[model samples]
Target: MQGPHPVAPPLVALTKRAMGGMRSVGGRLACLFGIVAALGACAVGPDFTRPEAPVPGSWQNAGDPRVSTQAAADSRWWKAFEDTSLDRLVELAYHQNLPLQVAGLRIVEARAQLGIASGMQYPQMQVAFGNANAVGLSENIAKIGGLPRNYFGYQVGLDAAWELDFWGKYKRGVQAEAAEMLATIADYYSAIVSLSAEIARTYVMIRTFEVLIDQANENVALQEKALEIAESRFRNGATSELDPTQAATLLESTRATIPRRQTALQQARNALSTLLGQSPDTIEPLLVGPKAIPKAPVTVAIDVPAAILRRRPDIRSAELYAAAQCARIGVAKADLYPSFSLAGTIGLDASTRGTASANLFSSGSMFYLAGPRINWAFLNYGRITNAVRVQDARFQQLLVGYRNTVLKAAQEVDDALVGFLNAQAAAAFEQNAVTSAQRSVELAISGYREGAVDYQRVLDAQRSLLQQQNDLTESSSSIATSLIALYKALGGGWELRQNDPVVPERTQNEMKERTDWDDMLGPSRPQEPKKNAAPAKH
Candidate 1:
């Protein structure tokens, strides 16, 4: 068969000369190495460039005094609430959340995959093999020659085949895996962002329920006093028995809400426990600080909208995934060209007749074969082309997905800003309502005591007070939670990882015990964002 290239004749002569002497083999290998080095310099396929995503130059709520366009002063945004308990919970969840640990493990897995891709730059196949077998010749075949009927054959050798990265297939593969590993790291930070916000939100819920229950209990006490007045008035013939009966009904109704609020509080605690990766029973002990809803600061530094591209891990992950897919297109395209490889085997072989033994290690018994090879799947209909198209399609999908992620991130920030601002406004009105309701209750109670008004007025005032108070509490909680949401949307909490490892040391130790992870599980920090780059334009 004809060789794949015009230079095959000279290369064939070189191979033959290599086989003639050991010194010549070394010189030929150096020549071959130089040839491969020169050819391997270029990589095939499209080089990755960050895709442009449109985002607003400024936040929609930038005009609001509470929203600042200055760069965020603190990435530990949970601390903005000035609640020590919330800060502790966030730290705990960062180290203990199961899902976050899984994300870190994925980084380790990606790193190993990268190592596999890198290894392909060298020999793709290598093996040391040995075998022994007894051979028996057929009588009919043996009769035609002066040969023994049976013999023993043995061989031991090292075999290796390295398909060089002449087409940049393996290089592209390494680039893809390297990008994937970075994406996984971003995923880990994304998990941290979620875990921190969830912990703060759940903690706020628990406090909200606590305050709501307190309000209900206070209303119950006020109603109990009103009932006493109604009962006395009825016994003294100053009012009808119907008044006391109505009073009793209102008291029981107010009392019923306490247990329900307690249930919600416990449920919130259970959710927080899960976020911390602890049993529900253990969560109560961690709830030791002041049982008050966290309060947001007067002003929050949200920075410009374009910063989201750099700050949000999901955005980074999406972009990196697209980049990785882009590299895959090159990998598939390389299959269209012929693959070049070098294969060789070196071994000792010997055969022994029935009563005789052979020395397999003798220099004369050793043999080796070495040559360059070429492979072309020229007959594959459209498989390789379609594969390239498939990767390109996926790359396009990820690009679109990345753009969508940016839009959604901007939406979240805008939504949270509106929610936070409006909830604060509503809370002001609710507070006023609570104050008016409290004054009305006092006036009604005084009037009923003096027989200047009906017991119904007192009941109405008390009901209004309870409802207004609960509404105020809910609105306050909303303010804090909305702030948490805004911080989350801004992707602030991931900066906590600057001082922490992606995986907890305890988890790393446990994983090491289960498998030989080598340096993959070691302390590794999230990569810092590139500086001074032009922000993505909206």
Candidate 2:
């Protein structure tokens, strides 16, 4: 190892002298800290209280056996579809969704902001400095004959200033930032809930299109055989040419539907690819398994309507936003009062004049300044009061917004429940229609082959069968998709985050390479409850 620096001894001695000076004022400093601490105990503005909002005691569909008031067991509600591919897609999206990653980065940014606010409780300004100067005295101003005409001066020292939190300005600032950080965390979970629902919805659409396309192809093959039989009869003088022409027209129309369904399938796949944060070409590999609409569970545990206050991330975020604004009112109010601070400067200074030279670090050259300061903006007409009013107004706005969010959440759950029940009923009727249409087509074909009925009967039965089959497919998809909507409306899927990191490890590694995050990028710190604030239920 390299030897110590040549100037280390003198630096150590200088530090010791500075420490000695600090000890001399330690008694007064302690007294000042005690006074400031007592003052900091009481903040200037109103404390935050959770806002109350109206909610129904139970959902409109609660009486149905398919809906339950019991607490939801799975936050990963998509798994109820019993589709391994959907489960895998949800897992992949949790790790790779671009919007979700953005939401996580916002939490990191908010954490840094909280750190900055917390730091304000300590010394506001601290600086170490050194200077050397050459000075010349004017002959006209120097009346003493022994006075030197020129001199050299040097200085090196430290200075600091701390603005006491007499009005709890810094404390309220910390509270605001802490609430904002929690809001960002809620936003991240909200992103998770949205991403999961959107992926499932898109996957259902893809499967719906696949089933419809298959039905259209099957109709086209059946219609082509019908066209061939009509032409054979017309050639043998048993049927008119109009029958063959009509059969060809029906076959072409059925073939036309395939391209439209294919287009929709491709679009759904591309959308899914975006949600997975991958290119469209890569989506095909993940979609290699069976292309069937996921089955929805018969019953969903939606809990009571009041549970939305705690279960919905957006609702929690809205409440946190109001809490953050409530703290800001205090921060703004604090500025109206006079600020008290302690400012001090200590240093070693020396000068060479006449025939004498003094060492810069000598006790004779030591200098210090210490004092308390007060600043009051008494002359600002009505600006400070108006600023406080502005913050209070904003807090009120957020309170109302939080209430509206609660009402909207309840509305969403109600709408989804109605849709799920109605779609299930419609699917039942469509299934019956498809079964009857299939039987009618078989009878019509048999009558035409035995020369007992006209070819138009065959065409009518075939068209009815195709229409009913497509209707049943659409209705079945609606049943599953409606359940997805209900799950999303109830704010399911965010609990998956309890076992996972908000920010991915790969992203954390990349951020570490760019900056020293220390423990900030590690596991999140436990939140400290604010005095007089309601505890948030996660």
Candidate 3:
């Protein structure tokens, strides 16, 4: 559907540009033809072939008990967390992130390149009309030379040039360009997935650090109280100075961690800001602490390994890159043979001359012409051979890249499962330790004040208790962070986005003018817009 506006800028510019281009050839119709000489009109080079996907039916040694997965890999797993803040953050990133924005621009670039490549298959024609003055030069020049030049000559004609795709070289180029466009699209998907993961991870870490800092502050207060009690007992000769001094040192240690934790929090936020394509300052307010963790959902499907390809954007990007390389190789191979092409031009021109050297166009001249042409490169066969080799090497390199992407995807899922599981167990253990230590601290301080126990015991109990409190908080953060990693490793979000990036209304209208030259001799007709399939991402 078109937007509710008249003559958007994109359309206006495209219209002007197309008109300029069409007018350049005296607005003539040029006959376009090709020889495709390779007896088969087939490209002399190897045809593009997709490399086999390394599809593993199942993950190796897979037995991480599936936690409650609320959504499948190809679903928006973040929604499972039930964090409205997280959902908002991801949506914002998709719309405004700079890297994502750049990826969109790349799509435009790829389209322009495709257009250029497609042009190679067509013949080029041009026309010109001008009037030139003639000097006094004719068969009777001596008699006429004595008489000054009298008139001007006018001339007009058509010029045409075309190269055939006999070897299919140009066709291969178009194929490669088309493949490249697909690769760029995959790249856009990959960027979106990566940004979502970074944002989620950073957000989790921010909350975790907040919890850690809060616990540290609380522990320091408890330690201060313990130190004061120990000092009192030492003055009364009920405890040694060693006990009071140790308690003070312990308190200082906990206090020292504060600045470092603060710095780390800032850094994670800064990193996240850049990923969102903003300055750190821009993100500070947008991503403050205390973001609610999504409700843990109980049963997301843990898919088979083969499904990962369909779920992960990086994997798809890699595969498409490989395909692009394969197509380019076909383009290179097609260079080894000859090509045939045809072209024609029809236009009118009239000119006038002042001097009479010999005028031809003065009476109104115009012409029509058409023909076929051939381009053969047998002597440069070695060069073509080298080009084919180079493309082969590139194809091999991209193939390896694809395999590595798959391997890494598998490894990440495994790693996330392990970390998440361990974090759960560790959190449980730390919770127990905190309860026991807190109880022990209370008893030890009471005993020291009553002169029933040395202050040393009080100091020891205070230290252990504070450590436990800090550890417990850290454990919570760990579990949450691990969960974030697992969700990302499995590829989160994007799949849930129901629409493609909205193109500027003007640009959509503009694209129409570029697609045709009004089909003048045969009235212009508009074709239905194509439907694009957003690639699947788990």
Candidate 4:
């Protein structure tokens, strides 16, 4: 550009002085922040130690060849069925399920809470503000001879204030928040595990209902044939009207089951659709064709009972919640100590006597200040101690809850294992009964056709075969569904979400459009979980 603009000597001197003042203050503030941060490293109160896990060495129901001490290999337990459709459904549910999405949102909320707690360790008051005002003193206003009647003033300043963590109150608060965030993550895993199991169970029920419907229709056809034969025999005076009436009754009874099973199938579809986070009709295309009931693998790994402490998301979540509560005890204890703070303000202020004028950077207007403040709640010890006791009590309750959760998880696994094993046995026996009944029905129908036996025998054999087949189908479905329940109890499928984004893309976009979050919604770095101490090996 052209020659440098000439500087007024007074303004130049003021600028140099102001720069020096700013340099001096900035240097002190930087050193102060560093010192405070270093001193803050010494946190008061009890440090956390993970509680020991209470569980058995082996599962009570793991005697079967299908169940063993080895842990499950596939975290995607649903994939063990080798069902393409089921795999797709689980994938869709992971992405689209609203409850799961809500769980993810909770994780985001917990992360924000942690951020807020961490921020408390830093300056609580930070702002740069400027104010301009005009003042006119009335004749009645208190005044002195040296004071001007009217004046204009302007102030530009930045102030910062920090409540120091002298007793580690803020650090303990941050610890609690971090634990809560981890608990939220565990809750998210729990949601996924439950959601996947539900989807598989519902699908199995639908398929079982479809099979039942087909069997009922087949029974209806057999009954119709018997009715036709009885009517022919009665018309030819070879049988009584009672025979035809009985046949008709049986055929109508079999037909009634069709509508019931169809209704059930539709309801199952609706439930599965809900799990996929869509309307009932949306799942029709996926479920329209005939599909076999999903079957479980012959052998399933049960893992050691203590593994529940790690594998079960509910158990993990409960323990993490207890840990968070444990930290609250420290937070409350920190309150018993004195509080410390540092407050400061650096500013440029100016005033004029005539129409309008300001000399903001002038030495006479520049100002800076800093000081320490202390507050001790010496008289509130009763309230503080009671509050701390309350937190400790809550932490103990959570510990008990965590233990209870472990027991429940073990019970569920036992129940599922026994149910699945017995169901498979029942299915096998029912299949044998079905085979024998089928042969009897064939013989009786042939004997009646040849006039070697009465139609009552035919009817009995047909009814027995139909019932046996239905029972077998039901048992088969139970085995698959029970296995799903067992997998859920084992806490499978949550690991699939590792490294996945917590918030859905659509929700993130909507949130961004709604407000300025200052990138608060960004993904958080994954934290290594605190492990519970295991029992000593014998």
Candidate 5:
């Protein structure tokens, strides 16, 4: 869009610049016509083909035999937790995380770099120049030759040149840059996947801390009541002084745990706030009271391990880097061959005597020239050959790196699967333990009140109950966090970025104020944004 108030250049200068510009442009067009007639050569390089995703037909730990191959991956896996707060938190992180935004900006940078490389495929030079001259006559020379010794001269013409792509050197450069751009896009998705997992993990930790804190407070209350009973009995001369001391000791021990739990809770909250791109107070309102930790869905689905090779962003990025390196190999190899190009000039020049004006557009003033050029690096053959070898070596390294990334992605998913499955089992056992301990605490306390058990027995039971409850909370949180890691390894969540602007509105606005992006920051059009699938129900 044009600025609200536009400024116009002076008409005379505008006309002059336009006229001068066309002189070179017209020459370039004529040269391009001849080049186009001969430009039917193939791009010299190995075309890119995506490597097969080396993955197992089925996950070793898929757990269920009934899982259908047709099951769709969860695009919104966190929503399976059925926790509205977590849903909101993930969405907020997507919008606000600065590091993820920086990743998006890297895509923009790569895109501009690609444009620079692509432009090299076109003519490299075109210029128009004008010159004027005057000379004073020597009367002695004029008398001898009967020639005018005073004269005025003027010249104006185009200069143009284009390096032909017969060996596809420039084409290979464009290919390399295009692949690099894809790699950056993949990295952007990888960043979002990592950010989402971090946010969920931190939030779960906060909730876990909250649960532990509540458990400690409850135990402290129980111990305090026990101490009261012991004090009442001692005052009535019915119990020993040692009994109240033991009760007081138990109460203080439980109370001491509160401060540590509170500290962890605050720190976890702070971490979560940072992930949300906000101040520490940002989560305070959402956590006004204790809330249960998010629970994993009952049924988990996983794609065959091979599916992850296509789904994971890190793997995709590694593969694209390899492709880019492969293209560079061709670009380097092309340096060994002689280069071809075309050069030309066309426009007007005129001379006038006395005070008469020159007619620059007259047929007598017109002139033209055009030709082909070649360059060889025959003396630098060793350098060019070694450069080709270097590119090939780099391409091999990236290819290996891509394979390693695939292996690592599968390993991560396998590890997460084991961790999540075990966490669920452990949480189940802890739930049972909590239940039994709760009953034991009640029985021990009742027995003591009726003088059937000692205060020591009541203390043991209460302590065990508190420990069991805390363990259960940790197990539950683990299940949730492990699920998040699994999804991350599976490369979910980034698909949401499709149809969304790569640059945030605020950042785009700031860029516009500081510099002209010149269509770089415009809406991503032409290319269909990439979408990734999610892991199946567990």
Candidate 6:
């Protein structure tokens, strides 16, 4: 065992309870000397409070029944499209995206940190043991030197240290870390939402490109037929050589685009595949088309500000971080005051300080020291005070950051609405154009067969028809992308993911250890979307 620790904190002014009760320096030290035997209990710290959310009441273009369920963003938003391939892709990314996996590990780290922080409020106990052997001078000669000649001994003991929380600083730190862990959890949810959205967007684009390629091929075929007819007519002296040359030139020009579109289509496929964490070649086939693109717009609900508060992970994370900062401020503030502690050591030992070096466990003369201690920070005037101020400043910064995040979320909803409405209009217009262009091509073919128009006129109509068809394809894809944007903006798809909940790397041991602290961590929020996940009224 050991005596109470000896030290005083800087700048810590002492009042000694009252003028008459003023303790002598020796008295204060004496009380501190046996503090371990004198004290018991946990410390002081402020509990954390989750900040009130400031979300908007309604989205700009929220169309139908809004999802009111919890954490829906973790699930696929594209289930509304009924596209199996898209669902598969989202699943793949959720499982394989490296960033998301890293984010999951981050959550684990936060949870572990929370555990460590919480532990600060508990009584800490430690055990130590030692042994020694030696040979030296005799007792008579050593007696003249006031020392023993030789010695041998061993010792083992336990020690405890507990800072009395008259101020609760450690508890505040625990609260702060808990909030930080919650924030990390939200980050993981956001990653899942992002992964699903990316896969859907890329899948739609790839499908659109496939449709455009088909149109390009048809255009080339029609142009070649027209060029052949023009040449035949010129050879028969029915048309000028100039007309035939122009027709042939247009045919080659239209044909040239096929290669370029093919390249772009391929590239899009590769990019999407990589995002899904697969080899480029692994996704080329998915681009070959017959993709089930979304045609029916999924109606979104207007849950207003509260929905954003509940649905957006970034917003939630920011709130949690803010809460953490608030708790930290309390922690820093607590540091400015003097600390009281209950500490002691019970051990078997012999003096190692003198010539009797080997009698550490001298059963006949075993030496042990034990006591409680009080530490007063009586000197460094500004250090503790400045630490508190620094934490205060940091906390203020987070408050600003949290407000900004909510503001940005509002902006995103507005932007998505504009895009969604425009995409709808464009799709409708492009569909009409394709129908009109197809009719024009049919009319031109009929006239060319009846000799009412030259073959070049038929070629022109066919070319325009092909372009309009490709345009229709592109418009549809854009509309699907817009829908995806809307879903993300609406903050849908946060549901709990499943399988064997992989205990986070940092927590696996603690989980197995079954500490008394386990129950104090609070129940984990339900991790999976309920079977009744869909909008109930709808």
- TM-score against native, each model: 0.90, 0.92, 0.78, 0.88, 0.82, 0.76
lDDT of 4 by residue, 1-538 (tens): 2676565575566656765866866686677667866787677666655566567677666777767666564687888888888888889998999999899889888877877887887889998778988988898988765668889888876789989886678877877887888888889999989999999999899889988988898888877888888898899888789888988988898899899989999999999988999998789777744467887887777667777777998987887788778778878988888777888876778888644465776677777777676788989949999999999999888888887888889889889989988898899899999999989988987887777889899889988989999999999999999899989998989988877777888898998788765554554444532322111123
Which stretches of candidate 2 lie above 4 Å from their native place?
1-33, 135-150, 525-538
Output the worst ten-in-a-row residue range by lDDT, candidate 3: 523-532
Our tally of clashes for model 5 stands at: 6
Backbone clash total, candidate 3 = 22
Q: For each candidate in turn, give its C-alpha RMSD to the true structure in angstroms.
A: 6.4, 3.3, 8.3, 5.1, 6.3, 9.3
How many times do residue backbones clash in model 1?
2
Global CA lDDT of candidate 4, please? 0.81
Off by over 4 Å in 1: 1-37, 143-146, 354-356, 525-538
Candidate 6 structure lDDT: 0.64
Q: How far out, in Å, is residue 419 in model 4?
A: 1.6
lDDT by residue for model 5 (1-538), tens: 5755332233234345555656776686667656743662545656656655466666667755433345656878888787778788899999998888888898889888887887888888988778988867676553534445677788877788988887777877877887787778889889988998898888788888887888888888878888888888789887789889988988898899999989988999888888888999768876653467877875676667777777888887887787788778888887787788778776677777635666766655666676667788889949988998898898888877777788788888878878888888898899999999999988987887777888788888988988898889888988888888888888888888866778888999999898868767644445622211111112
lDDT, model 2, position 71: 71
Q: lDDT tens string, model 1, 225-311? A: 999999999999999999999999999999999999999988998899888898999987788887789989878888688788889
lDDT of 2 at 15: 65
Candidate 6 lands at a TM-score of 0.76
Go through the candidates in order and give each one's C-alpha lDDT: 0.84, 0.86, 0.65, 0.81, 0.77, 0.64
CA lDDT for candidate 5: 0.77
Q: Highest lDDT among the candidates is held by which one? A: 2
lDDT by residue (513-536, candidate 2, tens digit) is 888886665444465334323234
Clashing pairs in 5: 299-538, 300-537, 300-538, 301-536, 301-537, 301-538
- Model 2 scores worst on lDDT over the 10 consecutive residues at 528-537
Predicted model with the maximum TM-score = 2
